[model samples]
Target: MFNIVKKMPKALWIVVLAHGVTDLSAGALLVALPFLKAKFALSYAEVSAIALMQNFTSSVSQPLFGYFSDRSPRPWLMPVGCLLSGVAMVASLLAPHYYLTLLFTAITGLGMAAFHPEAAKTANRLSGKAKGKGVSLFAVGGNGGFAIGSLLLATLLYSNVSTGVLFYILPYALLGIPLIQMTRNLPRPEVKQVGSLKTLRASINWPLLSLLGMVLSRSTVAAGISTFVPLYYVSYLHGSEMYASSLLTVYLATSALGTLFGGAMSDRFGSKRVMLYSILPISILLYLFPIVGDVGAFVVLSCASILLSATFTSSLVLAQKMMPNNVGMASGLTIGLSVGLGAMGVLALGKVADIWGMPVIFTILACLPVVGFVLTLFVEEPEEETVSLVVQVSK
Candidate 1:
């Protein structure tokens, strides 16, 4: 494992760590939410408002940033976005009024929107032939951040200085300088005008719909599990909050490992193949997830987690290639837009759980991955756009 990492470029390493820092802040916010709620005496609806604003802003802005980055190649968006994410989160936490906190959350989301598309574009360019590997390493950073962010925030809670959360900004602030210096020397986009809406629509064909469906389905299952698995642990398995949360941690940690493993495998085996295999088994595992005995359920759910996570890099890399000319747009749509849309899909499933109960919901969630698997059957391997782009650059 150490040797494999040693072979990766220094730039990718920096990007990965930067990604981790950015996502860590997002996770810490969730962890801090209960504390904030208690301190401010905020209602559940009020607490939810902050999340809504952040996600909504992030959803709307990501593709906009992608479109702009594609047209203009503003590499500075990368570092600027990073700085904004950290600063805005710190600001949001410290803001006196509830409305002010809401405003800061939106701004922090804007920073995330700025971060993903541009940074993903940079990672795509830097990836060379190992695009899957590069993006997987990048994906793991977000997973690691989410996993650790809670722990970090909990540790700091003892300090009784919620204001001290400001310190987390240092990683991105310091790293952003070098990232700016390094990416400035990287490849430039070909100087063609970005197509108008009509042409862009024409450029997007059937495969995009297929990919979107797959992304939506995958996101639905992920959101459902993240939201409900802990509930299952407590309500069904008769476990403590600590044990329930640890189950989530286990899923996330395994997924982080799976992301890198999947990426390396995809590079060797083809992204489409890896995705097909990763998702097809998911439906079966998910079906077993809620039906088994306690120990059996845990085993099944863990398998599902690992399989789904394994496809993270492959999916993103595939999306970028499928729309080679509009990679920034592709990256934004795939990572940010899909994720946002997918989160919404989970909301719909929440309604289902209300109507039909969790067993029914889990079964539905299990079946959703089949949509992704079937979509994979029709979607072709992308034209070797990465290779062709390199050739064009050398000329």
Candidate 2:
């Protein structure tokens, strides 16, 4: 990993940092959810609306932004996205009404949506022959940001939400200046001017659909675990808010390391193989998490997060490879739209928590990795010819 980073271009490193800073809003949003629940006196179902609004908006808009990026690279979106996401998260803190808070969260999602496809495409292009390593490094930044952002905001919340606003603003102001400078110098892509259908016929793109299915499964597990784990610690296990939030931080931090290694593993063993091996163990661990309870639960949950997050970059690189003619759109679909859709699953699971209980949510989560595993079996690896074509087109 150190060798890979050392070899990476400075521009890619900047993109990685930008990716991390951009994701701070998402990390902050997770910590804020519990606070929003208490401040507004919200039900599980109602509190879920905040995540839904943010995730769903990003889901719907990312493909559009991606399509636009494929047609004309817009490095400006990088800084704009960081600024918008950071500003919107701060606005959520100040918004008096729950509805207003939801609106700001949605805007934050849009910022996230705007940033990913273009940044991902840039990373893919700059990755040279080591696309898996490049994409994984990029993904680690986002995962690290999620960990840091949650921890930062959670600490700030010890004082109050007002203090949390400082976290949202200062990081972006610090990071956004460099992000703007770096993105401006990104090389332009030369894509085939094929019609969208001709590029990869959606109707016949079974591999693509399989990839989406795999991503959906992964995201559902991610969304459910990330959203509910803290609540489980607090509501069921009788832990403090700080303790609950810290568990979330542990989960995300472990995931960051997993993502970093997973990418390297995918390059050697293939993305499909890495995903298949990772998901089966993840399923077993997730099933054990809620049953373990207390310290055991923390240990089980952290272990599960490592395996579960290992699949993230594998799926991303596969999607780009599959849709070689439109990597931006592929990134939008895989990272943006699929994740957004997966986050929406949180709303349904939130309803389950309301109806059945939090433990039931974990039971449902355990099944999704199996789904991802089955889809991985169906995702035919891109042909050598396809890989060669992608490299040629990218050049």
Candidate 3:
């Protein structure tokens, strides 16, 4: 462990912590959703509306940030975004009414959108020969943040409708100011970073579009799991809020662990193969969600979460490699819009949950990974020479 840490660039760990800091907002949102639902007597659609607005902003704003990242360094966005997201999350929950919650949540998401592109671009460049491992480490930081936030909020509730619980995360936001400051003086990579519109032109090809679809698919599956699982815990399983949130922590934590290894595996085998292996086999696990009891279901779902998340690092790395001149743009698209598109699925699934049930929601979600698997077949892996070229440019 010490050797691994020693071998990696300091920038990777800094971003890992930064990634963790911003994502606490997401984890807190997931845990808070059911409570907010019960307090507001929220319909499934309304619950999803909050999620939609949050994810919508989070995803939609990435390209703008990515554009800036590619065009020039904006280290300041990291702290600003993290601070905005954390404060907004606090204000969103403490607001006097529901519409205010939606507004604040959207702002909070924009903070996330602001943070990811620059952070991801930095991680990729600093990753040296271990792009997979570097990206995976960065990915896991967000995952760990979500997991820890879930656990903290679930356990720290002072009351059933506790607004004060949201304050616990504020210190993290405060620390983020200095955390992101660490990146300011770091050396910029020597790559030929492109402008925003040119990024779109560069990515305007069949393979890139198809790969983007895979990015969307991967993100949606992740979104569905995070958005709905807590609702299922509270609604279908007759579980306590703590129980429901704990399950989400388990799911996210398992996914974080999987993220730890995903990059190394991608470097060894290939991104497409890792994508194929991760996304395809999880359907059976999800298919069994209803047949088992709560414990059994958690066990199955945890494993499924690991498999579903394993592709994240590999896919992001692949997109960056493919669009070497506009890595920030690719990172933004992959991290932001793709995630936004996927999280939007929760709105549809929420509508479905209103009509059918949670079990049906999972049943429907089971097929999405297969779709992702098929899309991977159309995306050609980057050749060795291509990767080396990008590395040389960055160096």
Alpha-carbon local distance difference test for all models:
0.77, 0.82, 0.79
Rank the models by TM-score, top first.
1, 2, 3
Q: Find the 10 residues in a row with the least total lDDT in model 1.
A: 191-200
Model 2 spans > 4 angstroms off: 33-47, 96-100, 154-167, 190-197, 200-204, 237-246, 290-295, 353-358, 390-395
RMSD of each: 2.7, 3.2, 3.6
lDDT of 3: 0.79
Structural similarity to truth (TM-score) of each candidate: 0.92, 0.87, 0.85
Summarize candidate 2's per-residue lDDT along 136-241 as a digit string, tens digits: 8999888878768877777877765555466657878888777888877766555443325445454237777987998998998988888788888888778799
Pairs of colliding residues, candidate 3? 220-342
How far off is residue 303 in model 3, in Å?
2.3
Write model 1 residue lDDT over 253-295, tens digit each, in one string.
7787778888888888888888898998989988887667667
CA lDDT for candidate 2: 0.82
In model 1, state the lDDT of residue 312. 70
The stretch of ten residues in a row with the least summed lDDT in candidate 3 is 1-10
Q: Quote model 1's TM-score.
A: 0.92
Candidate 1 local Cα displacement, residue 293, angstroms: 2.9
lDDT of 2 at 99: 89
